[model samples]
Target: MHIEIFITTNYYIGCFFIYFFMLYYCYYFYNMNRKSKRILVYGIVLLCVFGMVVVYKKNSTLPLVILNAVRFYFAGNPTEDVGYAPVSSKDFTVSVLASGLTAPTRIALTPDGEYMIVTQLTGEVFVFSRKNGVWNNKSRLAGKIDTSVLGFPPEELGLVGAVFSSDYADTGNIFFLYTYKNSEGEIENRVSVVSLKERFGTLVFSADPEVIFTANVPGNFSHQITDGIGVSIEGKSHLLFLIGEGFDAKRAQDLTLEGGKVMVIQADGSNPLGVRPYPSFPKLQAVGIRNAYTLAQNQYDARKRVLIGDTGPDIHDRIIYAPFF
Candidate 1:
């Protein structure tokens, strides 16, 4: 028989089993010679019938339709707010600006605040703008980071962060941090720049990127790549990025490896601004971070400190403070 027909027939078979079991139980209870045997058989039959009915309803579509009907009648519409209480705030009103974004990790706004670039962890960058008081997708920016080449799963190792240049209005340079497997098939994190242009009245970002910095992740273990890409609030020429411990907690303490360190590099791929005591890695600024998932500069404070949210090792997640160099 056809698969659909067989499945449908199974549902009826389950109902029949329950019906027969009940009838037999009732007949045995009234006319059985042994009272104890009757009770035991009834219990066993009830359990077997219940199991069959549960399995059948779980696999059949009819139960879903019945359940939804019951919910609608008793619980009202799922989208309707039956007992919602509105809370008012004197300072501000909150609302959703956009929806249907896939795994959005970072958002970067243009220098003029005319447009916003939202980066998804799957390597797609979407541009949104407020048109007629509603934010909508203007276009999708193109780039050349091959998400398939990453050694880890897409969610674990794809585009993590993005930041627009301070001269973005003039140069349209945008920076991104992403993960990809090197020629040796080892996972590596990279920071690159791409120039955005306009053609035919639409924004056209570069499909080819100019890679400025790259660091090799030591092992096949996934889960902690560099995150939180941002431009220095003090000077746009300086770029700040985080390097995770790459699943090795000890690497957070090691200064030699780039893992678990916050790095500063020139946007133009030149040597960093400050004088370096060690020539081995001049860009290395701060250490002892397990996995800095997010980074932000304090624009409100005059001191201009960089705030870091670092993931901990089974102990406690921490928010760290460091002065922006």
Candidate 2:
């Protein structure tokens, strides 16, 4: 549907440009002097020659040549295409680990590296493992979360992120972030934890999930439910979360709200870490963020520096870094 709309719109735009230019040429041809007319005739002849070359060869060189000529006229230099060099066959190889997935968003592996958990954007989780020297897909629904109830498109409101616990091998705990519609018919984002277990020789999750956090957001704003989730690495007791501003930039600076901030809390959702000079919201790590699309903790840095990719408002994108104490 989107592709059809795009092609139709561009087709109309191309028609408009062609007709408008034709009318302009007809009007100017009668009013221009002899020298101007000669120049216009030469330009039209050159364009016809270029079009014939493009139509006959069906190659990209004509467009590139035209673009290079324009660059030379404006910047006094034309771009050169350096040919590719030959390389040995052993330089690269490809392997397929898994297949037949529906819009897979995130993949989390068990601490022991024996099992892999894959999450789908359509609200499903699959577990993959190796058996008898071959990887097998043994996926099952993790819970009974109804994605249809979200009352919005899957791109806007659906399962967005997932992560495994650091002690997943022993505890079998997993976390997820998704969007849902509340009782008031308002869209909301939620983060929850659930335990995975083997029942009747098949891996499955508990029927219920322990809800950790949720935020009410406007239903029409799709960017409200951005990707960010808590991850435990190297037996770290603290879990890190990056929340977006929900299209409300002012809420980012407000300490009362969780939007547009880095939050750190214990694994059990207790004992929120306090930011210096602001102990009121212990979970608040940093604020004044517009839209943190990506978050990472530096493994090599001794200070446990947290890096954030913030989507700015009409100006520029920014990468922010701060200590994750």
Candidate 3:
């Protein structure tokens, strides 16, 4: 059933109401004096109602593009015929480094580059070492650490990433990011620090994990928190990572919130010392990101550039690199 109401500049407004205001809006547009006004009303009403409906329904999804009024004036995302740049096989060769692992989500190499720590989506952590041009199993660093596997949309949750401290050989500190169900049964992401020790040629955890950072978002995962790494910006070691908007795209612009932002913190999760932080936010390096997937950093003497993989508001998944300093 539908109810319709008609109104104009001088016409009497109807008192009719419905579960959605679209019913009256459509009716009002039909009685518009100009075709241009009717078209404008129709376009806006349809876009908003359709988008909201998609978000509320289970299994329903929005358009691939992020809906943003600001991006409309800018050039569209760059695309190519084959989707990615092609490299010559003579210059580079791809090979499997390791196998027999289940869903390895994040990996970190020690500062000495002797051992690599790998974390799986199933919450298992393993280590591997290279010998004679071949990768060999080192040991299982951890297993069944417990992760929230509810992040199906884009699968951006779980044991997402890990980073080794600059002095990993001496400090043995490894930072891991993973998702878990909080006491309220809501999925939350946390960064935990663990010390790894080698005893009798086997790697093992040295102590109880120390929780460093915790982020709370909606249970449904679209853009959860992502990877972090240790970087020296101007010779100061700091922890840098990225986060997604987690369905609240507007919050990406909010510096007070961690969503859709780049955060720079200490290895122990304190506000980074020595270097000046990003603008007013002590922990936040940058904001206004969509789905922060992966972060890669390159440094030369103190100049550091961070490459960020972000899935967009629309179909434009992008890899953007910039220096926060």
* Candidate closest to the true structure, highest TM-score: 3
Instruction: Give lDDT: candidate 1, residue 224.
Output: 52
lDDT string, candidate 1, 155-208, tens digits: 356777787765676678888887775676566777888888755433557557
For each candidate in turn, the TM-score is: 0.65, 0.62, 0.66
Tell me the lDDT of candidate 1: 0.67
lDDT of 2: 0.63
Q: Candidates 1 and 3: which is better by lDDT?
A: 1
Per-residue lDDT over 95-134 for candidate 3, one digit per residue giving the tens place of the 0 to 100 score: 5566676667777776766667788876777877665655
The weakest ten consecutive residues by lDDT in model 3 span: 7-16
Q: Give the clash count for each candidate.
A: 0, 0, 5
Clashing pairs in 3: 64-314, 65-313, 65-314, 66-313, 66-314
lDDT of each: 0.67, 0.63, 0.66
**Which candidate do you rate higher for TM-score, 1 or 3?**
3
The residue-by-residue lDDT of candidate 2 on 148-175, one tens digit each, is 4532222345666676665666777777
